[model samples]
Target: MAQPDVPDCPVDALTAECLSRIFSHLRPADLAAVACTHRAWRQAVAGEEGLWRAHCEAEYCLRSPHLPAGGAASGYKAAYGAWRSEFGRYGELAGRALRAWRLVEDWTAQHFPAVAASFGMGASEAELDAAEQQLGFALPPALRVLYRVHNGQELQFDRLVDIQRTAAHESIFHGMFGGYSFYSHLVSCRMLPLRRMVKWTRTAHTQLDFPRGDKRALFAASHNFNKMVYCDAADGLVKIACVDKENCLQAVPADAAGDPARDGALRWFEAYAAALSSGAFAVEALDAENPATIGICLFPQLPPGRSEAVTEGVRVRACPLLIPELTQVAEGERQYFFAYSIRFSLLPEEEQAALRGTLAGPAGGAPLESVQLRSRYWRIRDAAGQVVNEVRGEAVVGHYPLLRPGEGEFAYQSCTHQREPAGSMEGSFRFVEGSLQAPGREFDAVCAPFRLDVPDFIF
Candidate 1:
């Protein structure tokens, strides 16, 4: 009774949910073609608002201002078009930046909500346009996305770290990016708000001397010192001002770290995310009494830049941090400064059982009460692997810290000079198993090599 069997269209056989999922993979144009073939496909494309919503989230990341639900394109499909018209210049990059920033913000929100709160709300298109207009040149695509995400830090809160704010803020000595203390220098780096950034850029003509035709822009600075961050608009290379050098700036290429790039802003943020994911930074309280001022330290807490070694029962962990605020280029020689942290400790009593062979006590093979550092040695090398200098000293910073068993680390920081942007430091400490007054047999505790190079990313 039936004629020859009729074939069913494969797409027609799919449920609406399945069709929506498949359409998710296709571009808007491809989906449009499917809509023309049949009424079912057309309904799926036009009626499923969630499909278009997914597309919006995938592309814009909400970097564009929200369109009212009742606006011309209330449907997500239509909203997508409206956003494209306005904020599509760096949509892909903006989306990626937004995601990475969310990760960093989430970390701050969890550990230091005060700093997170200091982040400015996203800059509007009009505001960004005005800044670029006054800046006299268009912002690079990398920076445009950053401004859209956050207009930099709020100065009042920013001063809590960069400047000597009122004592009311407590011993809080750090900002969003931490600072190091050496001699009398106490400095922290912070992002400049849009207003300050504009002012700094304008004042460069008078306050700071730049070579004629030079167009490097300043976006960040330390309040108490000449430490500043600059960017070349011509190419998005981020640089730090070398106050001691005439018209010289040090590179701080944040993306691909050390590999120079044309775009700096987005790469800068990407480098931060990489540092955070790599555990190169930590959120800690600058002042124990003020939890609100907890801030991030850019010092590397792991790998290539951080080194660890153990000899007998003594353990040494060392790391280096480039001091951008102290860069200087003078007299045919460039001097970059680095602050290094050396953390040494003796193994706990329980863990020391493995080292008893070399550390056995005189009475019953028990471990010694402590180890006394006698001398220290440092080997410094330039990026070329050539030895530049060696240091042999009686004691570190004029103190022979006793490494008592099972106690916490005896940590201190000192700085050194490197002629180039990159170099390495490795050393060993001569120690005795007993106290300084009653010394035992001497041994060397190795300090693994650690990097002393300008960071791929500043904080």
Candidate 2:
């Protein structure tokens, strides 16, 4: 006799065992995407605390020193022990992992003797107090704890860029090139042939020297993030460099020359500079009244079929929000939640057609004659996966045109005056056609995922 079929149960749809098996086959980001699919999946995945723990361990291993792989408990124990042994203080270990404190206690003593004692061993409260007074602002909380715990155990030294070497005599006519260096809150960029450095120094009164022209540019920024620098020559050459640490310097010949390259480089620089200034690309205090503004300097991936144009006008619109009233600092930082409705529009007919075609392809292809997209104030999740706040806004759009190949602007509305460190927004766009029915297509746009760090203003 055949057995009766078992009815499907909700738990059976996603049992812990099944979910674990599925997770093993996917990456962290992929797992995150899957988790966002539905509440059931989210609950199942969330229950598997082991998954997140393993992910954290893997990340720590990759970013920190070498370590053997094991279960979450083993990895955590090993990491904790290693950290304690290296730093001799829990606060110090945590600070280093968070990248809030540089291993500069000793370096500070060596270079700036006046402030060295306060950071050295057996430092007194009075000494630290005095130092803080002199600096004008309180030291980052993590750094403060690290200094108190580690004292003078200087394991990580601040890397200074060798500007003189990178700026020295390099071939200019071969093609356009550029270099970048960051110290604290300052980021300096110069054109190749090292000519731009000369112009910048003369015009901006910023001294730069190239001691070693062969070395690469330093990649250190105040906030933790990798940056890529590109140089386009007047002829048509393009050169690119990846900056990983501070005080780095390097040079390379451009890939092309002429107007196209120059325009591209200039556009990119503008966007990059804007991003840097906006505080959206770095860590900092969240103050709505003093909201940070970020800009995109270049749009190399411009709408296709219009590479020869010299100038393009891009429109950016944002719906602003004023909510999450001011409250005392939590976790030593002020908290506020602001929402924005962001949109991009005024795209050329050709570019719009290209976008529509691309969207209409096999996976996301949805035919449309006109498309207007907007995002509501969705919830913002912190690194801990906790809902910090919600954002609400209308759809704001911007139009960007390409005047020439490899050059364009990404001008848009700026509403970064919220008290949250970093949050992502996702929504859908409404598409319309002359003859077809209006249809909506989902799109995800990243509003500045970078940190907003407080500036260490010397003046």
Q: Which ranges in model 2 have alpha carbons more than 4 Å from their true place?
A: 1-367, 374-377, 397-411, 416-424, 431-459
lDDT (C-alpha) at residue 296 in model 1: 70
**TM-score for each predicted model, relative to the true structure:** 0.80, 0.23
Residue 157 C-alpha lDDT in model 2? 15
Expressed as tens digits, the lDDT of each residue in 68-174 for candidate 2 is 22223334334544443433433323433323223222333333332233232423345445544543334333223333433321111111122433332211110
How many residue pairs clash (N, CA or C atoms closer than 3 angstroms) in each of the candidate models, in the order given?
0, 72
RMSD to the true structure for each prediction, in A, is 6.6, 23.7
**In order, what lDDT does every prediction score?**
0.69, 0.32
Model 1 off-target regions past 4 Å? Answer: 1-18, 28-42, 46-57, 60-86, 155-174, 245-262, 285-294, 329-331, 354-365, 384-386, 454-459
